[model samples]
Target chain A: MKKKNDWPFILPAIFVVAVMTQVPFLLTVVYSTLRWNLARPDMPIVFSGIDNYLFFLKIPDFTVVPEFYSIVLQTIIVTVVALVICTVIGFLFSILLDHPIPGVNIARTLIMGPFFVMSTVTGVIWKTTILNTTFGWYGVLAKSIGLAPVDLLSYYPLPVIIFLFCWQWIPFFVLIILAGLQGISGELVDSMRIDGLNWWQSTFRVKLPLIMNHIRVAVMLGLVFIVKEFGLILVTTAGGPGTRSYTLPYQVYMQIFSASNVGRAGALATMTVVLTLLAVNFVSKSMKKNNL
Target chain B: MRANQTLSLQRTAQIKKVIKMVALTVTIYTLAILYFSPILYMLISGFKTEYQAVSPSFVFTPTFETYKSVLSDPSLYGYLGNSIFQVLASSVLCLLLGLPAAFALAFGNFRKKGTRDKIYMWFLTTILLPPVAVLIPLYTWFHAWQLNTTPLGLLMAYVGFHVPIVVWMLYSFFADVPTEIMEASEMDGCTRFQQMMHIAVPLVRTGIISACLLVAVFIWNEFFLGFNLTGNDTATLPVYMSRFREQQGMFIAQLSASSTIAILPAIVVGWMTQKSLVKGLTLGAVKG
Candidate 1:
């Protein structure tokens, strides 16, 4: 009776999750194997096993490698660089805020402000106010110093995007690491100090090892966020300069909305799901290992 | 012997204190500037006149014209209303569906743990899948259902996309509540619903609030889903802001103002719940 009663309560949520998330994913896999386009409605969905995948592999786009590899490479580069920078900086900031310093709360608030700003806002703020070649603050400053103002969007698209990604995501890492820092028992650190360990030794030998799980979680969350990021790309470059800034998600958007190739877009989406699953699985396994 | 040991301990503490202070100060200042610059720039740009905003000169006359422009537009209010309605409806629906499911999973020792875990994983896996993958087919599906360009349609989609994360976050929070509390309530003759309402609800209030705030911010800031799902009639702030480029051209100050307006609510909420906001952002890490 108790078991039967519980089923009604659980069923709605499970139903929603299955229908909304799982079903779409399954459909994406099915669509990837078929040939369909937006232009023709009456045309039957043709079953072309692996054809779309093969075609995508051969296509030469600046975003991906060889033809499609560049995009993936650029994305990997951006994600890695941004993750490393943000994690280090975030750790540093969290350590700072963890101190018994006055105004730490104020400083923390100021630092966290940017994270709340939507990606669209972040993109616009960087592009128009700071990096705009013609009228941006950086451009103005450069020109005043008797130097040519380089258009960030035009000259260093990938770096600019990577920098923005770092800026937006750093606070997230800071908050997480700070929470983890708080969780560390003070007595443990005191005991390490009593054993004649220096601050560096304590941090490296004691503090860091304890927070490994947190760090893993932070990195995984960061990876998921960076992989899924779209607003910044959309607002800033719109995957511009002939697809130089195209990442996997943007490519999927272009294929479906712009190119109207439903099957190819689905194929890209499937690949994204597979990659994300791999990342999630890897992170979870490492976390489990750390716990053990 | 004790005095000597104490003296040596004091000296070491002093040295450690100095190093820690120096490191903390430097890190704090650098992080402050790095994180705060873009937001400061945006807020400053919003107040500047078009000419001042565009000029190479750092010093400029500020004006309220941009704010005036954003406020005077009637559609801005409409967009704001639509955003509020959709976010509130979706969040409410997510909680209604999510809370019970979370309760059942956390408390009920269901027989099929494997099936349950698989379902949970499947839901989380949606976070990994990009929207464009299913965009076309979903579009066709929505169109067939006559849900395109409707607020209810958009809310349903938002609820669908968000419920998994909501469930996961709530589940973790619920799991942490001491089972003894629920068991105690049962011993006191409280029924399941009564126990959930009177016990579980109050205990997890912080979690519920955090989840709601996080979900609200996400719904507010969501662009692609809002862009694809809603037309002008149902557009949210992100979609409204996107229209600025096409409609207003390169009016830099006006654009900044609109951006500022769009981000204002999130900033306010983030400030209020800065602690939990951080917690929510790093939910995956803390749980793992």
Candidate 2:
């Protein structure tokens, strides 16, 4: 039923998406160019040109916590580490589930439960109940057994955040690779026997290769999702303990709400976008190269 | 002697298989319990008194006090109801706005497939774009228009964020609707709208439902946008829940009760759409 010009049917959606996504992006870039500090009434709004960009760019050291460059590195490390660990654990679970074990049905549902939990809930649950030093479940268990309950939140905040990230995200990898593994034809498994391949050999060779694309999808999606890990950070540590747990997004939030530095916020956001685009470019290029 | 040796080898192999099966079952149950322990712990804590809830004691008398206290707060239900309403509203809007576009892309007699692919990728990029980039400008624009805290503005934003998934998922669905049916409907003097409403939609009802479910879950769980955009009347459950967390005292039991309330619907919807969720989340790139 589509005519030669079906563009009219699509125009409204295109308009709304562009207005919401595209216009905001352009405006963010434009905002970065201005000295729009709401807190500092003494300094009027003016064209700051590339000054805003330089503000983040001119940070001298790469090791400084809460710094733009450092936060970018930290975000990458946290996201990549979490993604890798989650993928490994998720793949193991997927492989375990691939076999027809007794009571697998109920176990599968239970395993998938954490993925559905809200970000704030996961963060708050972990922070207040699971990781709370004096009153957490661990504390209760430890004290019952005649041991001291060390404060994980105070000493190991970033790892705790990463653990929370993995807990919430590993299930995603399970979903991805399990779908891929289920797609594998039974004939392939039969052929594994014909080829004299052992069970471990069959999984590593036949099963893993078949789901390489799915693994790639999981990792790529992880990159896309993990960078936006704000809600979890906001509730758990709020990037606390002197910025040891800070990420780029958290830093961006601080720049706006904490400092009220609109210019610097805009500039910092632009840099974050650039950093994200670089990873996106890599993902897309690798996706195409891998013929995914 | 050869028959006896073969029989012994086969028996040993059978024993190994049984052991492996038992181990896998044990591992599955163990991991499931470990993975779900956080939610279970929270649920238990919700029933514990304030001291025991904080103490994390296992041997405490259970109580419904926190649930009662949290539930008695009228605004909790209001925020939850608002979340439900907004999610439903945005999902419907996503479908209404996205279906036509998806249908156009899937069945249109476009000369170049590349144009179609590029347009689809453009939308895909928007979905993947770090939402923080847009937050500063959107907050400003919404504030300028006094639409930041309004349901209508928030609805539009959710629809915009969610439509790309709808378009992509429904594109795959509509593509599966055999063209012969559409052509036959066209021959019977049916309009494009009628063809979609009468034929294509009914054929792929499961697809549309799954797409909406996926979009609803995403929107319902979304934070940054809801956190920054809405207030008071438009406060989403997530934003409201965050506000509760920020308040003075640490009430783990109360917080758990609220968290359970906020997450209950998502769990139900998520379970129902478990299969289609993979498709919706991956935009039909990977199907379960």
Candidate 3:
């Protein structure tokens, strides 16, 4: 009777989660093996068996490579670069905001404002108001200095996207890391001061090691979200200027919606999941090594 | 002569400390303002007229004219209502499903020694699965059933994706509840539901509130699944904001106003959850 009670308590949640997430994911894996296209209804759906995966993975010509490879590379570049910057800069911001200055909460609140705003909004606001060529702040500032404004979204899509990713996500890093900083006991801080350790020594040698786990948590969560970011790229570049800014998620969107190839999209989606897990595993392993 | 020299040195030191404090305050405030200028400018631009927003000037004549125009558009209300409905409904559903499971995992008996940990780990891993993994199948199913024509389909997806998060956060909160109290309640012949409602819920009320708010914020801002899975009538605020992308810097004031409306609630709710969010996230992830 005691054991039976546990299943009843947990069954509803387990059932809903499985049906919603786990089951669909498994179906996606199955769909990757079939040849199905939404647009071509005349052709019957049949087993393709890894053809869809090969569509993205196969390298017939080594000279140029495929768009799939580039998209994957771009995704890696954006996620990795953004995450590195978010951690470093977010730590700096946390340290700055962690000071016991008056009205500090207001400053912290201001920094956090971007994280809560929807990504689509962030994309549009930056593109139109800040980065626009003729009508934006970038354009106006360049004109005042007698320099022509280069369209950043077109010219440097990856860097621009990385910058925006850092801007939006760094606050989240700060939020987690700042909490870790505050969790340090007052006695520890007093001892650091009493030892007459300079600012750099105290910050890098002592405080950083203590907050390693917090940084790990922030980075891991940041990785999961950043790797799959779609809305920002969509509203900003729309993976345009010849698919230079396309991330994995955006490519998956294109595969399904634009190409109307269900099987290929499924395959891409599955690869994306695999890559995410690998990155996550790599990060956790590295952080653990660092912790020791 | 020694006393006079010491007094003079102490006064100078006090003066130097005051100077340093003032310098630090100024520096911190300046950086904060600079960092936040983009959103600040957006908020200000919402008050400007279209022509006034044409340039990047900060000084502007404030007006309700742009806001009034944006708010009166009928389509805006459709997306807003959908967002509100999704946030409210999905948050409630997630809590109802997650609370019991978290309670069971934290305190209930399982036949196997590791069953509880296994189930909890399963939920945690599910949180790591990107939405794209499930997108294809759910899209096909929703399309076949024409589920996108109504808001129910998206709400169900939101609830599904978010229930894990709720459970993940609340599991830690439930674990913090003293088992002795629960055991005492059980000895008094109280049902599991009675103990949960009377003891567990009250003890972790803040956690529940934060989880609900966090889920609400996520559902509100969710774009990938929301965009792919929903139709025109069922689309949410993020979709509405995406439509402004093709405007090419035109309609600056109107765009600002609408986005302000779309983003305000999430930001407000997000602010409220910041305290508990850190606690829940760090506790849950670190322990695992």
Candidate 4:
């Protein structure tokens, strides 16, 4: 057999990926070392050991609300909250869908609507129409009932933003869990039922164990997603009113675009890169282990 | 006595079935309403007058004036055109660049068995980083090169954005092509490329379509990349939609109306490819 090298076919893909990904990836590391602020180009470009990383971490000036540590804490808080809501609600929805019910297809479509919505539009729809508090539906309903209109985003920015994120991702969890549920053998379920197992017992003991991998993957994907959630903050809060919604990804954007601090932005971007890489590694590792 | 007992048991079962059916319907519909109300309200807002948009109401006379104004706005068309151009170009490029790489992974012969796996892992890792991480540096690089804010830069970014998904989806589909077919093709003097073109590609036509649709939705809705990298002339739909919110502060009607137009295509695509697209999200898990 003639050994034709497949590298010929793959070269275009490699080139594209390299140009788009690898070059920038390397540049991120190298850029982090130099004081590369475009606003202050007169300053000679010199190696600044760990100054960039230190500045972003310490954040001496409190220009933004909830500087540095609060931003990181806020990121973790919102992501975890979103995941919790997504999984709990998604699990219930999946269970509801397990039955052979009428109008299920329509129901599924409705449940999955947010997945189709763009992230920017998602922030807009939530901020203006749903969570606006001035003319939003929630406010209207509250006022109609003679109650004080609650400003959710104003008072509870992280939770409201978390809900918005949950709305977008809950369907994802439902689909994944539903897929996992369907993969379990019907016969095993029937036999379990025959062996005197009730619905709760069967679900917790047999079904949960079988679908653990799916749940884990859903969580891993969700973590990666939350780490990258930037536009939602950009459109809605813009990290305002005291840095209540100031997240790390949003901070990175503000640093580069708003503040014109390349060194700090690069450091922030590097942190994001490490976090995402670890999450991806965890997902891939678990998947490989399960498959093997 | 036996006949009476049987009739009583049947009645109990019948009662149970009725209870189950009613409960299922209630749960399902309730879940649907809870999940979909936000979007439904957004759609409703689009049909109202500005005052009505601000004050949510069920009894107001619905109007299409907002839609009329939004559609007639000349810049809306420009934003739509930019969206269409970027989405179509990136999707096509994803197929062109990713399909071949997928094919290589699926059928490539290498010096070491792990070579394909190593390269494929590297590709998937690229997706792990948030778009911001890439944008922080890529923006600087592209700006220096005068490529930022250009349609060309946006296209290039989107292609990079979507290629990993394309490669992953296609790689799975191509791998599932029966090994026997490839073997037979080899026996019949069909080259690997010929085998891919004639057999593998046709077999995974649905996968290709699904990838295209998914990529299209992502590109069309992509906010950050274009938000940062591209400007008014090159910005896509979501960027324009946000601009409406920022510029026309209380014009809720127009913003929602523009958003409706922006999102209609994605919703249509979603309905069209619901099955395969969901499967793709789960990384090739199809429910049995």
Candidate 5:
């Protein structure tokens, strides 16, 4: 048999992807090492070594932590908390949703609604329509009970952002996890039931392990997405209240667009990518170990 | 007497089961509705006057005034058109570029061992690369080439980013196609193109539809690139939604109406893709 050349079929995708993603990413790494500033265009673009990275990494005073560290911490907290909540609640929701009940499809569809909505829209809606202390449901409910409504977005930005993240993402987790649950063979389920396995044993001991692969997929994909979410933070808190809610991506956006410091922005962007890949790798490794 | 007692016990157990089912159903519905209430309220709020939406009360005379006014705004059309164009154009382009690549990755033979896995993994890693990592270069390039002024620049970025997703999804879908059929067809003198177009595609028809829908939902909701890359005229609906941040408590009805227009398609498309989304995503990763 004549060997057909695969390059013809694959070249276009590789070319486009390389030009758009790979080459640009390489450029970003290069940019990270330069002293380019869009604001100070008069200054010549020159190699600056690791100064751009050190700007974020270095600490001038031991007592006063830099904003970058806090931002990274906040990002970690938000992503980790949101993922944890989404997994726990989403697993419960999936179990409830997997039952053979009439009109369950409608319920499932309703729960899946927010995952599809744009992050910006999610931010604006939840912020103004739900979280607004003056005219939101939270406000009305609070006032009806003779309690004052505190501004959650400003006062508790991380938790609010984390909550919203979980809300938007739990459906996704459920979607995948439920599919995993349903994919389990009926004979296995029947056998477990016949063996006098109670609800807890069946769910945690058997079903959970059976669906660990699905959970891992959900977590991995969710982490990849949620780690870099900028729109929600931009629209909700705008990384305000003293940079309390800023994530790495939001910080990167501010660095380039607001500060016009291209070098620092590139450095930050590179670090963000590194951190994301690290987190992903770590999660996959740990999950694999646990699954074993 | 023993038989009668057992029948009564069985009837009581059946009643208990019925009660449990009813309770579980109610809980599920309640949770679903509550989980969905924020979006539901926004949808319902779209039907109210600004004054009616001011107080967040569920009870009010619903009106289409807000929707009508929102639809009549000239500025909204630009962003809407851009979003629609980006979604349609990018989805088609992604399919065109991705289908062949995914087909080749699934079935094509490479010179080196593990080349196929390496390429596929390369595509997967690209999915993990957030838009910010490529934003700076793309931004500068777009500016230098004067591509930001036109829709094509953003469209190119969208296609570049999304093609991997399409490749990722369609690769899995194409994997489901039996290699024996392709081999047999090759023996029958059917070309690679014919085998892909006629055999593999039709076999994974649902996969193709779901992948397209999934990508459409993603590009529609994408904000990071859309927010930064486009100029005012070229901005998409996400940009429009972000602008609503300044409205605060004012114009609640208009905000709701506009957001409804923005998110409705994605929600519908997302729902459509739900069944196959897990299959496409997990089947490929879980097995390997």
Candidate 6:
């Protein structure tokens, strides 16, 4: 069989990806080593020889590095909490709905609504309508009870933000895990039941083991998502309360756009990319080994 | 003796059933309220007038004044049009560039499989890199190329950022398509381009459509790129909303109305392609 080498067919996309994505990425790396600002057009690009990185390390208010670290911590917290809660809830629901349940499809549809909402819209809704200290619905409810309304934005922003994130993402985790659960064979479950294994043992030892890969993949994907997230943080808290809620991506945003420090921002961005790569790679490899 | 054993088993089953029912009911009620409350708030606020928006009352006379204002605003329409055009352009451009590359990577025989794999990994790495990392350099390049503040510039950035993921997705779908189909197409004297357009394209049409829809939503909802890249002429809905918030402050009930409008297209697309959307979200799973 004569297979034609289709470089002609492939060249356009390769060129497009290389020129647009790869070239820009390389330029970013190059620019990270140089001193230049958008505001000063005449400033010659001076090769600073790790000065950008050294400055980031030395400066107190170069909050990008510490801020990125804090963001990573916040991402870990939010992702793990959300993933665990959503997985448990999702698994329980899937098991319940596996049996004959009334209005199951309707319940499913309502549950899936959050997954469809744009992240920005979700952020806006939470910030203005629900969690806003002044005109928010929660505030009204508190006022109606003749109690001093709690300031969610100031007092406990992280937990409140985590709660909102979990609320939006739990439905997604539920849907995916439910789909995985649905794919499990019934005969295997029945056999396990016949062996006098209680529902708890059957779920933990049997069903969960079988669906562990799917769960891992879902959790890892969720981690990537939560880590890369910016819109919610931007809209809801804007990393307020003295940068308490700042995540890596938003930190990068602040450094580049707000502080006009592109080199430091580039270093932060590079570090984030490296961290995410390592995390994702570790997760997938571990899952593969365990599955084997 | 057998009757006694059967009765006890039946009783145990009945108790289990009751417990499961109770557990499910409590879970459903709690989750439903948690998930729906914010959305309900948004919908309700969309109907409130400017005066009522700031009032700390859940119970208020509903009004369509916000929606009316949003619809009547000329800038709102212009922003919406810009968003629509930009999203459509980005989606089409991503598909055009990504599909063939995905085909080559997934189906074609390359001498350097390792290199191809590296390219694939490099693409995935882009998703992790903060968009800000490239913003300054890309902005400078845009100015140098006279591409700044243009819809085409925004579209190019959108396509550049998104094509990798689209390729990653379509690669999996293309891999799933049996090699026999391509073999058969080749046997019929069809060129590689013909094989792709006539054979592979149709085979992965579902994947293509899903990728396009997902990319469209991302592009439409994109803020950083559009906000930084476009001025008034090419500003997207997100940029418009941000400006509205900054300019009008609390007086703008129209921001909520505009937000609801901005999200409508994505919501509709998501509803139509719920299964595909889920599959797209979990693309890594099915492949590995």
iRMSD for every model: 2.6, 2.1, 1.1, 2.1, 0.9, 3.1
Give the per-residue lDDT of model 3 (tens digit) for A155-233. 9999999999998999999999999999999999999999999999999999999999999999999999999899999
lDDT string for model 2 (A1-292, tens) is 3444778778899998888877888888988999998688798889989998888777566565436666777798898789889889999999988888877877877888888888988877777776666666777688779988887766887788888899998888898888889888989888889999998999887788778778877887788888888998888777878787889888878888878788888888888888888887797578657754
Q: How does candidate 1 fare on TM-score?
A: 0.90
Candidates by DockQ, descending order: 5, 3, 4, 2, 1, 6
Best by lDDT: 3
Q: Write the per-residue lDDT of candidate 4 for residues A1-292, one digit (tens) a residue.
A: 5487888777888788778877776777777887877788797777887888887576556785436778878888888788878888888778778777888888888888888888888888777776666677777778779989776767878877888899899888987888778778889978997899988988877887787777776777777777788788878777766788988788888889877778778888888788667756776577557644
Report how large a share of the reference interface contacts model 6 reproduces.
0.34
Q: Is the docking of candidate 6 incorrect, acceptable, medium or high quality?
A: acceptable
Better of 2 and 6 by lDDT: 2
Q: What are the clash counts of all predictions, listed in order?
A: 11, 0, 0, 0, 0, 1
Q: Which stretch of 10 consecutive residues in model 2 chain B shows the poorest summed lDDT?
A: B279-288
| lDDT, candidate 3, at A287 | 99
lDDT over C-alpha atoms for residue A154 of model 6: 71
User: Candidate 3's residue-wise lDDT over B23-134, tens digit each?
Assistant: 8888889988988888888888999999999999998779999999998999999999999999999999999999999998988888888999999999999999999999
Q: In model 1 chain A, where is the ten-residue run with the lowest total lDDT?
A: A59-68
Report the TM-score of candidate 4, chain A only. Answer: 0.91
For model 5, how does the per-residue alpha-carbon lDDT over B81-189 read when each residue is reduced to its tens digit? 9999999999999999999999999988888879989989999999989888999998888767888789999999889998998898888888888899989998999
lDDT tens readout by residue for model 4, B196-275: 78988999999999989989988888888888887667778888877654532377787778788888899889777777
* lDDT (0 to 1) per candidate: 0.77, 0.81, 0.93, 0.79, 0.92, 0.72
Task: Please report the candidate that would top TM-score against the real structure.
Answer: 5
Worst 10 residues of 3 chain B by lDDT: B186-195
lDDT of 1 by residue, B1-288 (tens): 999999999999999989878777777767786669777777777888787776744367778988998789899998999989987998899899888877777776566667656655665666655565556567657767767667887787788788877777777778778999988877788777787788888988988887877888889888877877676788888877765533212577888888888998988887776676555445533553
The full ranking of all candidates by TM-score, starting with the best, is 5, 3, 4, 2, 1, 6
Question: Looking at model 4 chain A, which ten-residue stretch has the lowest summed lDDT?
Answer: A58-67
Instruction: Mark the regions of model 2 whose C-alpha exceeds 4 Å error after superposition.
Output: A1-4, A60-66, A144-147, A287-292, B1-9, B57-61, B111-113, B187-189, B244-250, B281-283, B286-288
Query: In candidate 4, which residue ranges exceed 4 Å CA deviation?
Result: A58-66, A280-292, B247-249, B283-288
Docking class of 1: medium
User: Tens digits of per-residue lDDT for model 5 on A1-292?
Assistant: 5577787888899889888998999999999999999888799999999999999999999999899999999999999999999999999999999998899999999999999999999999998898888888899899999999999988999999999999999999999999999999999999998999999999999999999999999999999999989999999999988799999999999998989888999999999999999999999999999999
Pull out the clashing pairs in model 4.
none
Candidate 1 per-residue C-alpha lDDT over A188-285 given as tens digits, one digit per residue, 9 for 90 to 100: 87888789998788876778777777777778878888887887888887887788888888888888778878788888888876776686788778
